[model samples]
Target: MRYSTYFLGCRVNQAEIEFFEDKLLKLGFEPSKDGKADIIIFNTCAVTNKAEKESYRLIRKIFATNPSSKIFITGCIVPLNKSFINQVKERIVQDNEVLKKNVDNIYIIPSTQKEKVIEIIEKEIIDKPHFDSLEISPKFIQRSKYYIKVQDGCNHFCTFCIIPYTRGRSRSKPVEQVVNEIKDICKNIGNNSDFGAEITLTGICLGEYGLDINTSLAKLLKAIIPYIPENARVRLSSMDLITLDEELIEVMASSPKICKFLHLSLQSGSNRILKLMKRNYTIEQYLDIIDKLYKTIPDLGISTDIIVGFPTETEEDFNLTLEAAKKAKFHRIHIFPFSFRPYTFAYQKMRHIKIDHEKVKEFEKKLMILSLEQSKNFITERQGKEYDILVEEGGYGYTHNFIRIKTNVDKVNCFVKVKIDGIEEEKGNFAVAKGLVTLPV
Candidate 1:
């Protein structure tokens, strides 16, 4: 069977899709060709109403376009959007012989049952029983970077988030299991120095990793540090402020294998808006951490999420967010306009109060401008400095602190030490530092 995959959410979802792709490849499946894939696995997201709608729409489009392909829909939307599931089912009920022949064509697998998807396909999908007997290995297409999902779900239940409802309670893979997985990955990839550039430990809530198994993320890092190659690096996908502690910082500080960049999700900067959102951390706490985080981790590039138009957000609230962004010196800011999502407290309590659309657009523009300005400062701070970067296929790689630098170096999947020779700022492109590789005489 041949397959195609799609996902529309965070890094956690991206990691899950990569896992599915590897699993399916091992099952004698090839990439889609001959004008139609035999299967399509779409990992959907429902973080916002727009995302949810697009997820369903994409599903419908896939079904319509790939009539012969078995469609598997999974992820956050699988549990929450039953009406859309029923809509698909209603179409399946139509009097069509082709559809009836493959009445089981569409599989709606929930997050809870994701692990069983391959098992279901193995048993149910006819004439594919010898998949396990064949000697096959997954060839990851990406030249560099591997995303390993160490944790799943979240327990925080932020008032504005539907993730808790969709992903359920926080849980983790055992420390041994994760370690073995990494070992196997390294073994398969080898120390060729031409691959294995980076591995990202991803999760819905990464900081809570290993809590159920009597360990912590900090300890997990300490354990894995010895196994990772000195050239390759490990990175956390994102972490909530509530569980982030000094221990994690200390781990990052001690290791050269761990990336210095941290993407901490700070939803809103205004104290009042934060209270309304029921976020556990306050602005004071966030700013203090920022102050300490930069002091501890040298050249650390901090990025964050900021919501622009929460219903109760005022001009003061927006201004406060701008000020906070400036103070944080965030290299990147993901500005998500407040989206109305069902089952979230914000949706239930303040649905009637709406922020002006024009204001939301204005806020987005302002934040983006500030993000670039801060990023310029970050780039300027690192200029004329030498750093090792793992060159990806595009001839560009990020430094330890996630500085994107384009270089003349074309060696893919290998680390090269380059000094930032010049900074390029163009209208459309993100500011990229020009790198010149320095070789020993």
Candidate 2:
């Protein structure tokens, strides 16, 4: 049997697809380089209403293209909403009413058990030629760096978010497993003839890496760091403010192999909004964690997530968010207007302030402008500065601190020295730097 898979949204989805690939190979299924396969798996995301809709659209398109192929739908989409699956069924029926009668082999991959997920992949490959068991890994074909989902799911149920219901609770891979996986990946990369790359550790909540078993994220890092090859880099996905401790900061600051970029998910700035969201940190505590990291990590790049237009977000609350963004001067701000997902606590409440569509757009626009201004200041500070850039393109890459740079030479995935040029008046600061910078001996 031949199989191919499509993953949508988040690193964890990608990681799961990689595992499916391993299972398929072990069961004797050949990987379809193109979409021509006996089975096509759509690993979907349902983080938001838009995501759910998009998942359905993708599934329909895949089935239309390969009408004879067996289709499997999985990921956060199936478990979160029964109505959604019904809607998907209707959409397919309306499009191809006659075909629906013959398409009776549809399967919804179970999410509650990892064993079930594996079983589906294995069954899809049943009766195929047996091959050696392949290690669960991603192909470094594009090698523009990688994301290793070191953990899965989240325990925090922020009022506006749907991830908790979709992904279940937080679970951490054992320290030994994580280390071994990374080491094997590094070894595989060394043997590959095509490209050299590094892996970034990602999770639903990275700082909670070892929380399930009382092992600290710092301890997990201590285990994985030594295993990554010196030539390859390791980056963090997102850590919470409450999880920032001296040990973790020290490891990040001192490790040359770790990228200086940190994404701390600060959903909102107002204490009231924070409380409503059930976030564990106060604004002051979050600020303190950022301060500690900035003082220790030279030229660190801090980015954050901001959710504006929450259920009860006031004009004052939005201003507080602006104030914190200015103070933090984050290099990146992924500002999103809150979208209500069904089944969350905030969904049933009617007394909260409603965000008119026009007003929500205005707020998000303002947020983007504020984020750009902070980025401008960061680029100004680094003007005429040099950095060790991990080259990911022929002549383009990002600095250790996560500032993007472009050039016209063969510089992909190789560390090179470059001088920071002033931010271009257009395209924001993502296009600065004259070229690679040499490190001082």
The numbered model that scores best in lDDT is 1
C-alpha lDDT score of every prediction, in listed order:
0.79, 0.72
How many residue pairs clash in each candidate at the backbone level? 0, 9
Each prediction's TM-score versus the true structure: 0.91, 0.88
Name the best candidate (by TM-score). 1
Error of 1 at 235 (Å): 1.1
User: For residues 1-441, could you state the per-residue lDDT of candidate 1 as single tens digits?
Assistant: 788989999888898888788878777788776536877888889888778888877776677678777888888776545566665455433665665566568888777667656766677774455344212234456436888888989888777788887788899988776777677666656777556468899999999998888889999998888788655678888898777778889999888889999898888889998988888879999999899988998878888899888887888999998988889889888888878877788788878886699989898899888887777778888779998888876778888888888888766788888998777643321367888889410
lDDT of each residue in 1-441, candidate 2, tens digit only: 798889898777786777676566655678897787887777888777778778888877787777777777778776545556665456544657544864654566634454454555454435343333323443434454666777877777877777777677898877777777777677766733234466888888888888887787788888877767656678887777776778888888888888888988888889999999888788998887788789899879999989878876888988898888877879778877777776677876632667776777777888888777777778778888877666664566777777777655463556566787776443542334455345411
- 99: Cα error in model 2, Å: 5.6
Q: What pairs collide in candidate 2?
A: 391-412, 391-413, 392-413, 394-411, 417-436, 417-437, 417-438, 418-436, 418-437
